[model samples]
Target: MTIQVLPEQLINQIAAGEVVERPATVVKELVENSLDAGACAIEVELEAGGLNLIRVRDDGGGIARDQLALALTRHATSKISLLDDLERVASFGFRGEALPSILSVSRLALTSRREIDQHGWKVAGSGLLDDGSPQPAAHPPGTTIEVRDLFFNTPARRKFMKAEGTEFRHVDQALRRLALTRFDLRLRLSHNGRRSFELAQAEGDTARAARIAAVCGDEFLANAVTIDEQRLGLRLWGWVALPSFGRAQADLQFLYVNGRNVRDKLLAHALRRAYHDVMHSQRHPAFVLFLELDPARVDVNVHPQKTEVRFRDASVVHDFLFGAVHQLLRRIRPEPGQHHRVEFEAPAFSTPDPVQSSVPLSYGRNVSTPSWPVREASGASGSAWPLYRAGFAEPEMPAALNATEDAPLGRAIAQIRGVFVLAENRHGLVLVDAHAAHERVLYERLKLQLAADGIASQRLLLPEVIRVGGAEADQLEAQFESLRRFGLILDRAGPESITVRAVPALLIKADLAALLRTLCGGADDAESAEHFNEALDAQHRILADIACRAAIKANRRLTVPEMDALLRDMEQTPNAGQCNHGRPTWVQIDADALDRLFLRGR
Candidate 1:
C-alpha cells in the first residue's frame, strides 16, 4: 500500500487519546495553555466533572484573529521554530497538540484577542469543514475556551466515566497540581456554577507559600520544609512536607519540572528515597519541587502530552534534588509532644460480707422507695432470695487483687515485650509498642532534622570503594567528587567490581558488598557516580534495622523511671502516635466503653 497522510480530524482524535484521559485531562491541558500564555489570572468552570462543559477564561496573551484558526490546527504551534527547539522546550503547551486534540473529541469554541488588538474573534466548530478548515467570527482580547459534550462520539469512553462527584474530584486534583506550580498566578475554580475555591495572586516566596497553604490546606504548609540548592547549574526551590503531613497514599505529592506539573517514577523514587529511613514503609512525604535549568539542557518534546521529559544530566539533577531535600530536612526538625501516663487503682483483695442493711438512709432515701424488699423463690432452698440485692452473693464473688501505687506499670501489672510496653491505664489498658512508638517518635524527630538540618552522617573510618560494571563503572568513576560529598567514597578498584573498603558509619554493621551491589544494580541504565552516591546516601538514611536495635524491647521489664521517660519522650515526639510500621503506638479507651464492658451499668 502506498503511504498517505491521515486526515487532520482522525490524527487529532488519536492525539486526543494521549492528551485527554478524562474531564481532568481537559482541565489540565487548558490550564497549562493559559499558564503558557502568561496569564496571571485564570478561572476554570466545570459541569458534570467537565464531561458536559469545561470553560477556561484567562487574562493572558490571547490569540489574534489570524492566528485563531492556526491555534485550532494540529501541530501548528507558536512554541517551536525548528527541530533544534525540541531540546530547549520550556512551555507546558510546547507539543502544540492540546488544542487540536481537545477540539477533535468535543464541540470546541475558542474566543481570543491579543492585548494589542482592539477586540477578539470567536472560532466555532461549524466553520470546521470536511477537509479541516476553520472559519472564524468576531468576539474579546483575552482567551476563553469552551468545551462541550466531551467524548460524545466515543460512546465507549463515555461509558467509562465515573459518577459526577468522583469525576469532579479528579478535575479538582488537576487544577490543584497546576495551581501549586504557579502561585504567582491567581486561580479560581468553580463546579456547576457554585464557587468552590480561589487563590489570590502571590508575589514573594512567602506569599506564594501562604497561597499554597490556602490551597493545599494549612496543615501541609505547617509541616513543609523549604528547599533551595544548586547543582551543575540547576536551581531547585520548593517545599517538602514532613512524612506525617503526607496523604494516606502518594497521590497528594506534586512535582514540577521547571514550571510544568509532572508525575514521573524517577521523581517519586527520589522523594521516597529521601524519606526512606525517616518515614514508615506505608507513609509518604508531600513535596512540591521546582527544578529550573537551562532550556537547552532538557528535552520536553519526548511526549506529545509533555508531562515527562529527558534531562540532559539526570544523575546530577537527581542528586541535586535528593541532597537539597535531604539537607532541608536536617535543619528544621519538628519536635514531639508529650503524653501523660494514667494509672487505674484496683479494688481491695478481701471480699466483703454478704449482708443487707434493713435500715434506710434518711438523707439518700426517696419518697418512691418500696416498703418491702422484692424477692424471688429459691428453687433448692425454698427461701426468698433478694433479686435486687447488692453485695449479697459473697460465695460467687472472686477475690480482688490489690495493687500499690508505687508498683511499676511495666513490671507488676503489665507485660513488657521486645518492643511493646503494655500497661493498664485509668479507663482500661494501654499497649505501648515501643518500637512502633520510637519509630514514630524518631520519624517525627528525624523528619524535623531533615527539614531543619538535612541528614547527619558519621564519617567512615575509611573511604568505601564501589566498582561499577563496565561502561556504568566509567560513569561512576567520572563523578567521584560528587559521590564523595554524598558520603560514598568510590575509587576504581578493578574492571567490574569496585572494592568496598569503608561505608558511612550509619551502615557499619550492614553488609557493605551487598549494599553497594544493590545500589549499583538498581541504578538507572546511564547513572553516573554522583547518582550512585546519592542513592547510597539515601540508603544510609534508612535506619529501620538500626532504629529497631536502639529502640526499647517489649516484655523487658522497664524500671518505672525508664517507662516514664519513654512515655514522656514519645508524647513529645511529633508523629509518635504511629509507629515506623504505620501502626498506632497507643489507643484511647473512654470510661464509658470500660464501664459497659465490665457490666457495671446499663
Candidate 2:
C-alpha cells in the first residue's frame, strides 16, 4: 500500500464506522449538537427504526450562509476557538466530527436559518447535490439535520441493527437520560410515525420527577430515594431506588456525566458497591444519577459514541459518589425486621388483642385445663379436641423416620434455639424456623381475607405525622386507598414531603422516616392505591426493625408441648425452610451425611 490521502467520502465512511454505530448514535450526535447550541426545544423523528429516514430539529442558534459549508467539513466545530478552550470544554459537544461522521454513513442534509437571515440554506452530504440549494424554510433561527438511508452503503453494519422495537427502546432510553438531566427543556420524540414520548416544558426537578414518574411509572418513583451530595469536587444528585425496588436486569440504571450521557465502568462499580449489602447479587437497582464536575478534568472524546469518559482523578470521583450514596442509604434506611407477617392461634378461652396485650403467658410441659369452659353439651362432649388444643396427646401411634407413605409425621424430636422446631418424618428429620413458618401462615390467611373482602384496620389514637421525600410523597398520594388498608394515613405536606399520621399497628414502634424512605423505592405499581398499601405492608415486613422483638429467637427455651404445636404449624406452612428473602430459616442434614463425616459408612 502506498501512502496516500483518502477521498472525502471514503474518509467519512471510515469515521462513521466509529461514530455512527446505529440510529441512536446518529440521534446522540445531532442532539448533543443541538444542546451545545443552547436549544430549549428539541424534536426528533425517525422512520423504519431510523434506517430509511431520521430527522432532528432544534430551536438553536443556526449557522450563517457563509459558515454552513465549513460546518459540514471535519474538525470545524464552533464550540471552541482556542486551544485553551479544549481543556475547559464544558459544552455537551466539543468534537466537530459528529456532522462529518453522520454524513458519511447516510444521505445527509443540513438546513438552517440564522437570526439575521430570512431564509435557510441546505447542504447535501452525498456530494451529488449542490451546497447552496434554496429550500422552503421556517422563520425563527434553528437547525434541522436530516439523514436518509442509514448505512445504505455498508451492508455489514446494517445487518447488526436490531429490530425496530428494540432500536426504538435504545432511542427512548437515550432521550430519557437527556430529559432527566435537562428539566427545563421541552423534548418531543416520535418513531415509525407514532409519537412515543413528549415532555412539554418542564419547570424544575419536581416537574422533571413527575415526567419521569409518568414514563417509568409510579412504581419506580415510589421506590426511588433522592441522592444529593457533593464531595471531592464531584456533585452527585439524582434518584436511586432501594434494593427491593430493583429489576432482575440492569435496565433501569441511567448515568450522566456533566450534561452528556455516558456509561463508565467506574460508575457501575460504584453503584454495585453502594448496593453491596442491601441488594442480592442477582438483582440490579433502579437509579438515575447526574454527576456535575469541572469539565476540564474529564475527557468526553475518549469513545466514538462519547458514552465512556476518562477522568483526571477517577478514584476521587468514584469514592465520593459511591460513598455518598452508600452512606446516605445506610443512615436513612437501617436494616428492617427479618420478616413482615406473624401468626398465632386464637385462644380457646380468651380473645385478648395481640397488639394491646404484652403480658407473657406462662408455658410448660404440663397442659392446663380451662377454668370456666367446662360446661359441655351435644355430641362433642369430652372429645379429642381438647387434647389436640392443649398439645398433650396424639390420636394415633407416632410414625417412624422411615415409615411408608401412609404414615404420619412423629412427635417433635427437639426445638433448636427456640426459633426452629424439629420433627421426625418417614424419610427424614425436618427443622423449621418458627418465625418464617408463622409468617407464611399469616401471609396466606391475610391474602385470603383480602380476596374475600378486606383486612380490618385499627385507627391510631393520635395520628403521627412523619415527613417523606417528594417522590414518596407522590407515591403516598397515589396509593392512598391501599395504604389505608395497611392502616397507613398518608397525606401530602409540601412540595417534597408527605406526612404520615398512622402506620400498620405491627410497625408502630418502627423508624417511620426510614420505612417511608425504603418504601418509596419499590418496583411495583405505587400509582395504584392497592400497590401503595402493599408497599407499606411489604416495607413493614422487610424494613421495619420489629422482627427481632416479635420473632422467636435462638436460645429461648421452649417446652415439649410448645415444640409439638410449633411442629404442627410448620407442617401446614407452604415453604417451611426459608423466609421471604430466600434465606434458609433451617437446614436439613441426613443420617447418611453424619455417618460419612464420622467415617462410619463408605
Candidate 3:
C-alpha cells in the first residue's frame, strides 16, 4: 500500500488523541486557552461529566469577529508564531490544536465580542473545516467555548470514557489544578445544575491557605508550611505539608512551572529526594510547589498537552529545588511568638551539612549552650544518663550561666513516663519524645564524627560472611570506595555472597548482618547521581539504627539535671524537629490549646 495524506478531519482527530483523552483533558485545554487569553475570571459548567456538555466562559481578550473562523482552523495560535517564540513560549495553549481537534469530535460553538465591537458573534460547527460564517449575536466583551456531545461523531473514542461520576471527578481535579496556579483568577465550577465550587480571587497568604484548604482539605492547611525561596535566577514559592502530614499516595501533590501546571519527572524526583531523609519509604510528601525561572531556560512544547517540560539545565533546576526544600525542612525550629510556623530563607544551591559547615555546634562559649542547674542524685543510673563511648559526650559544662533571653524551647522542668520530657517555655507547655530527641542528637554527632576524621574501622574477630544476590555483589564491588568512607570494607567472596571485613567503630555493638542487609536493601535498581549522593553521604537508615541503640533508652531513670542537659543538646541539633525516621521529636501545645482542652473560656 502507498502512503497518503489523511483527511483533514481525521488528521485533527488523530492529533486530538495526543492531547484530548477524556472529559478531563477537554476541560483542561479549554481552561488553558482562557488563561492565555488573559482571563481574570473563568466559569466552567459541566453536564454528564462533560461528555454531554462542557461550557467554558472567560472574561478575557476576545477574538476579533473576522478571526472567528480561523479559531476553528488547526495551527492558528495567537500565543506564538516564530521559532524563537516557540522555544520560549510562555502561554499554556500554543499548538492551537485544542479548538479544531475538539471541534472535529464534538459539536463546538464559539462566541465572542471584543471591547470595541457593538455585539458578539457566534459560529457553530461539528467538523474541523466548518464552511459556516460568524453570525451576529448578543453582546459580551469576552469569549465562551461551548463543547456539546463530546466524541459524538467519534463513537469509538467515546466508548473508552470512564463512568459518569469518575469522569466528573477528573474534570473537577483539572479545574482545581489550574485554579491553584493563578490565585488572582476567580475560577468557578458547576456540575449538572448545582455549583461545585466558586473560588474567589485570593490575595494574601491567609486567603491562599483558605483556597488550598478548599481544594485539598482543612487538615492539610493546619499542618502546612508556606515556603518562598529565590536563588540564582530561580524562585520557588508555595505550601509544603510537614512530613508527619504526608499521605499514602501523591494525590495532593500539585506542581506548577512558571504559571502553568505540570507533572515533570525531574521535578518529582528532586522533591522526593528532598523528603528522602524525613519521610518513610512508603509515604509520599504532599506539596504545592511553583518553580519560576527565565522563559528561555525551560521548554514547554515537549508535548501537545503541555503537561511536561524540558529544562535547559535540568541538573541546576533539580539541585535548586532539592536544596531549597531539603534545607527548609531542616530549619523547621520554633520561632518566637510563632510556635509551629516555619520561616523561609533564600536557600543556597549548595545545602551545607550543619556538622561539617558553619552551624557552630561547639561545646564552648562560641554561642554558649544553655547551662541548667543540676540537682544532686544518688541512683546507680546517674552514671548511665551521659553515655560514655567513642564520639559521645564532650567535657562537662563550665558551670551554670543564666540564659539572657527566654529560649524558644524553655528549660526542662520534669521527665514523665520515662518516655516523654515535659518542659516549660514562654509558649506554654512543650512535650518531647525523649528517645526520639536523643536519637537525633546522637545521629548528628555521628555525622559530625564521620565528617571529621572518618569513623574508625573495627575489625571483626573472624571476618563475617553474608550471602547476597549476584547483582548485589556487583553493586557492592563498585561502591566499595564510597562505603569505606563510612568505615565499611566489603569483599565479593563469591557470585552470590559478600564478606564484611570491617564495620564502623561507632556501630561495633550493632548486629552486623542486619546492618549489611539494610544498607544494600534497594541497591538493585539503577538510581540517578543525586540518589547515589544521598545514599553515599548518609545511608541514614543504618546510622539511625546505631543511634537508636545508643540513644537514651526509654524507662531509664533520669534526674532533673540529666534531663535538662538532654534538653540543651536538642536546642543545638540540626533537623532536631524530627527523629531519623521522620517522626517529630517535639510538639508545642500553647496556652490556648490547653484552655480549650478544659473548656476554660467557655
Candidate 4:
C-alpha cells in the first residue's frame, strides 16, 4: 500500500463507521443534531427499523440557505468556532461530523426554512462529499432531515444490522434514553408509520416524574427515590430506584453529565459502591441521574461516540456523587405508609422521634414493667446477648415514644411465629423480621464501634487454635493489625497454625477457628493495604456472621416493650430497611389497602 492520505469521501465513511454502528447509532447521531439545533419538539420516523429510511423533523433554529450545503460538509459546524469553545462546548453535535458521516454511507436530504425565510432550501446527496446546490422547497419553520438506504455503499455494514423488531427495540431504547435526559424537550418516535411513543415536554417535579414514568417505566418511578442536592457548584438530581427495584443488567442505569448521556466508569463505580451493601448480589441498581457541573471541569470530547467524559478531578467528582447518593440513601429510613415496591403497598416505618413517654406500650400490659430481658444463660460477659436482649428491661433507654405518629415503627403489638414481629403504626400494619432487624441494628452498632474506639475485645476463656496453609499463615501475619481493629487478636504459632486469643464480644459464640481459616485462606496479598482493610467482602462477612448469630433467635417470645425497643433501634439505624443479607427488614400494609381487601369502601 502506498503512503497516502485517505480521500475526503473515504475519510467521512470511516468516521461514520466509528459513530454509526447500527440503526440505533444513526438515530442517536441524527437526533443529537436535532437537539443541538435547539429543537424543542422533535419527531423521529423510522421505516424497517430505520434501515430503509429515517426521518428526524424538529421545530428549532433551522440552517440558512447558503449554509444548507455547508451543513453536509465534514467539519463544518455552527456550535463552536474558537479552540476554547471545544473545551466548554455545551451542544451535543459540536464535532459536526455526524451529518457528513451519515451522508457518506447513505442517501441524505436536508430541508429547512429559517425563522426569517419564507421558503425552505434542500440539499440532497449520497457519498462523494458533494454539497449538491440547494433547491428552494416549501417547509415549515424548522428542519427535517431524511436519511435513506443506510450503509448502502457498504453491504458488509448493512449485513451487521439485526432483525427489524430487534433493531426497532434498540432505536426505541436509544430514544427513551434521550427523552429521560432531556425532559424539557418533546420527543416522539414512529416505526413503520405506527407511533411507537410520543413524549410531551415535562416541567416541574410532578411533570418530570410523569415523564420518568413514561420513559423509564412506571414501576421504576414507583420504587425510586427522588434526589436533588447541590454543593460546591455540583448538582446531582434525578431518581434512583430502590435496591429492591433492580435490574438483571445495567440497561436501566442512565447517567448524564451536564446534559449529555454518558457511560463514565467513575460514575458507575461510585454508584456501585453506594449500593454495594444494600443491593442483592449480581443485581444492578436502576437510576436516571443528571449530574450538572461547571462545563470547564469536565471534558466531553474523550470518546468518539461521545458516550463518555473525563472530569478534571475525577476523584472529587466520584466522591461527591458517592457521598450525595450514599447519604440520601442512608437517610431514607422509610416514611410511614411507603414501603419499597418489593413487597406490600403502603407507607413504611421511619426513624424515631425524641418525644418519649414513660407509659408502657399497650400490648395488654404496661411496657414500663421490665419483663422481657430475663437473662437465661450467660450474664454481663456476653455482649452478643450480654446485657439483656432487646427488651422492656432497658434501664439504659430513657423511654419509648408515646404517640404512634411519633414512633414510626409504631407500638409493638405482638410477636408472631417466633420469627416475625407484628406491629401497628399510624399508617396500618407493619410486619418485621425480628432476627433481620436485630441483625442490622447489631451490625450497625458494631461498625460504628469499629469506626470509633475500635470494637471492644473480650479475651477468650481459652485460645482457639487453627491450622492453615503456610501462605495463609503469612497472610494472617500481614493483616494482623487490620484484623486487630475488628477485635480479632491473632498469634502465629507455627508455619501452618495460629491462635485466636480474643474476639469481638459479638462474635464470642461464632466458630472463630473455622472463620479465621476462611478469612486467611483466600486472602489476596496483592491487594492494596487500604483496600484490604476497607473493601474486603470477607471482612464484612465476618461481622455479618457475628451479627447474625447474636441477633434474636427465631421462635422467641417477647414483651411489648422489648419489641418496641427493637423497633426504636431499627428506626435509628441506616439501611434498616434490609438486613445484612439484603432481605427486607420490615414490610408495611397500608390501612387503606387492608380496608379495600375487606371491601370496606364498598
Instruction: Please provide TM-scores, in order, for all candidate models, with all chains considered together.
Output: 0.62, 0.58, 0.83, 0.87
lDDT-based ranking, best first? 4, 3, 2, 1
lDDT by residue (57-109, candidate 2, tens digit) is 99988888777767878888888888789777788766777788777778888
Q: Rate the local accuracy (lDDT) of all candidates.
A: 0.62, 0.64, 0.76, 0.78
- Candidate 3 local lDDT, 1-602, one digit each (tens): 99999999999989888878999999999898888888999999999999999999999989898999898889998878899998888888888888889898999999998988999999988866467689998957899999999999889999999988999999999898988978999998999998999999989866887788888776676666778899889999888877766688899999999988889999999998888767767888888889999999999988778889999999999999999988777666544243342222223345566766654322111111111111222221122235425355554653332333456666677788888987777667677888888887777766766667766688877898888778767767777887776678889899988898998765666677676555666555544222225453355655666677667778876656666667666666666667777777777666655554445656
Q: Backbone clashes in each candidate structure, one number apiece? A: 44, 10, 0, 11
In lDDT terms, which candidate is top? Answer: 4
lDDT of 3: 0.76
Q: Write the per-residue lDDT of candidate 4 for residues 307-406, one digit (tens) a residue.
A: 9899998998999999988777677674554563122222223443456434333221111211111112111111212222443244454454554666
Count steric clashes of candidate 3: 0
Cα deviation of 260, candidate 1, in Å: 1.0
Q: In candidate 1, what are the lDDT values of residues 1-602, reduced to their tens digit?
A: 89999886778888888988899988998888898899999999999888999999999998877777788887788988887787677778876778888888888888887878766777767213233333454545579999999988777878999999999999987888888777788899999999888889888866887766766665566556566788688898877775445467776577888887776666677777766655666777777778888988777767657777777777877787777775554343212111212223322344544563343322211112111111221121111221112234423322222232221122214445455565544434445666566555544444444445453445556656645566656655666654444335666787775645443334455565655454454445443233344444443334333344334444455544344445545534434444555454654333544454334554
- For model 4, the stretches where C-alpha displacement exceeds 4 angstroms are 129-131, 341-405, 521-542, 556-559
User: Candidate 2, which ten residues in sequence have the lowest lDDT sum?
Assistant: 366-375
Let me know the TM-score candidate 2 reaches against the reference structure. Answer: 0.58
For TM-score, candidate 1 versus 4, the one ahead is 4
